[model samples]
Target: MQWITIFKKEILEDWRNYKWIWVPLVFIVICIMDPISTYYLPQILESVGGMPEGTVLEPPEVVPSQAIMMSLTELSMLGVLVIVAISMSVIAGERKSGVAELILVKPVSYFTYISAKWAEKLLLVFTSYLIGMLASWYYVDLLFGQITAGQFFSLFFFYLIWLIFVISLTIFYNTIVKVPGLVLTLTVVTIMAMSAINQIFSYRMPWFPNSISGHITKMLMENSVPNALWGAVSITIILSVGLLIASNFILKTKEMAD
Candidate 1:
């Protein structure tokens, strides 16, 4: 009941702020743009700058899986930045407005307050992703070729798990930092830095959430998931729980308004 109450409040706030609408629209554009643009890339290149005479305008073949994967990569780089930028103020904004203090004065636990943020944002992230991805999948089939349902869903399912880690980590960072700009920078830097580190030692830490993007690409190109991928899922789950606890602790001790 407590979580439901907080979840409703979070949703209403997002609605009022237009996050519920614009965030999904951003993802949909990113997803659909990939296939549509790739399908017309040759035309686009030709129109922008004329190709040399006698040059064969043969574009490389676009595979359905690869097209979808590219759409997700857009999500990873630009999409993560957009989503984090929009949701960066979840905790930080509340604290600045003194809403956090007002809520804490009542019979609310920090765990519930924090979990509500985590859950609502997670829902926002995943729901937008799924819709965008499904649209991408359809257009990929239309523009390129069809991938087996098994292959497409496998790629999507695993990628979604990693996205959960992204949203959760951002929420966790927001709890610790009060400045939205600093929070945004730190969250992006930390996650991107971790991804870069994992890339350096990929063989040893294939299960890292950052690695999931590459793994999904791998799955698209190859039919099988690498054995180490499950480890990444397990690690992400454990890390998500740890982040929730850390955020809860911070909200209780240091989440005061300035």
Candidate 2:
């Protein structure tokens, strides 16, 4: 019940801060741009006419699935930065501003406090992403080709787990680090390190969370998903939950010290 109360408060704060507006707007622009640009690329190149007079430029046929995937890939970079920027401050900023102290001194458990924050952020990010994906899908279907509902849902489910991992990692650092800048740096470094490690050891460890992107691509381009993907999904879920628990534990420890 307290979580619901805090969740509502968080949502109101986000709206007042313009996060609800700008975050989703950014995602929509990022996603839809991919499909629209890809669709008009050939015509735009022809209009330029800078190529050799004798050369005819032939753009490869772009498929709907590939176009959608490309948009998702772009999100993993720019959109993820947006996520990090917004989430880095969820705990650290609150703690620095005395907001956390004000709230925690009340009847709220630290776990309840963290849960409410986590749930609110999760809803915001996931809703923004879903809206973006749907917008991109509309263009991809109109310009490229029709994408099956099954394919759309599959991609959605896989990417959701990946996002869970990302948000959890950022929130974990936010709880432990007092400075938002340091939390951002640490979160980015940890993500990059994990991604690099997954790249290096993908053969031996297909269950890494970073491997989810590859699995998504495989499912799209190859029309099949590896059985080992379930292992990756399970591990990702476990790690996400572990990180949230760790965040709550660390926050409690820090509170007791203070």
Candidate 3:
């Protein structure tokens, strides 16, 4: 009951902040632009007339699947930044403003508090991403060709896992770091480090969380899941759960100290 109460409160807070509207709009706009831009790139480039006098501009032959994948590539970069920026303050902001302390003084457990916030954020990110991807799929289909349901859903599934993993990491940092800027820095740096490590040692570390992105790409291009897909997914889910548990543990410890 208290978790529901907290959940409803978070929903109201997000609504008041216009996050519910603008976050999805930002995602949809970013995704839709990818397909449209790709489709019209040749025409747009020629119209600008910036090429040398003898340069012949040829239109690119982009398939629907490639177009959709390109949209997701942009989504993974820009969309992940949007996700991190929006969720950077989930717990840190509350702690900074003293709202977290006030809430904990009431009849609520820290686990309940953290779980509610985590659930709200996960839902928001997932929904925003799904809508954005679907919109991109539609445009890619209209412009290039039809992308099969299997291809679209496969991309959505793994990418969704990657997004959830990032959300968990952000919330974990939010709990320990009271400064949102530092929290953002730490989360971004950790993600970049993981990606770099995965890139450097992909063969040895196929099970790493960051490897999920590689598997997603492999699945899209080859139309099949990599042998490491399950391993990467399993590790990512475990790490995400571990981060949330650690977040709850850190919050509990902080509460004990106070």
Candidate 4:
């Protein structure tokens, strides 16, 4: 209940401050861009004549579900950037603006404060992702055809997991770093580096969570359950909890370094 109050207050402030403008814009871009690419990418590619004079390029078959899912996942980089930006303000911004002192003067514990921020950010990210997914679904279906329930849900599940992982990484970065720019830069670099590392060593380190979401998405596209999905879920949970703990600890130990 207390955490909810904090979350509500922060959400209200977020709305008032329009701290969410980029989120929807990014989502809309992802939703629209995906279908456009799906519909035109093959033609665009084939227009570039690169073979024998008599050679012909076959148009790629467009599967509504697969195309939509691909678009959603492909634009995931935008989603990750938005998540990091939103969460960068979670703790670091408060400290910068002296809002942390005002909040701490209240009856809120550090845990409640951090928890509320995480909850609010998670809700915002999930809401944005859902909106993007639904819009992508409609556009793809309108252009192509109907998508199956299982396919829809499966793709949505994969998106949700990927979004959660992104949010967790952002929160972890926010908690550990004091500067927003540094936090955002470091987070992006770390995620990219970890992803590359995981890819290069995936055969030897199959349990690496960084690449787990991509593997899951691939499996979902093939309509098969990948064993790595569970590992991804577990790592996400662990990272989220660990970051929450670290944030609370930092808040408790550090004064408002204004």
Q: Write one digit per residue (lDDT tens) for candidate 4, span 50-89.
A: 6567656664687775667666666557767777877886
Tens-place lDDT digits, model 3, residues 1-258: 999998898989999999999999999988888779877887898888887887776658887877887777777688888888988998888888787767778878888888899889888888888889999989988899998899889878887888889999999998898778888899999988988998899889898988776787778788888879888888888899999999999987775223
lDDT of 2 by residue, 114-201 (tens): 8788889999999899999999988889988998888898898888898888889999998998789988999889988998999899
Instruction: State candidate 2's TM-score.
Output: 0.94
Worst 10 residues of 1 by lDDT: 249-258
Name the regions of candidate 2 deviating beyond 4 angstroms: 256-258
Worst 10 residues of 4 by lDDT: 211-220
| TM-score between candidate 1 and the true structure | 0.94
The lDDT-based order of candidates, best leading, equals: 2, 3, 1, 4
lDDT of 4 at 12: 91
Q: Each prediction's TM-score against the native?
A: 0.94, 0.94, 0.94, 0.85
lDDT of 1 at 210: 83
lDDT of each: 0.83, 0.87, 0.85, 0.73
Q: What is the Å distance of residue 225 in model 4 from its true position?
A: 1.8
Query: Which wins on lDDT, candidate 1 or candidate 3?
Result: 3
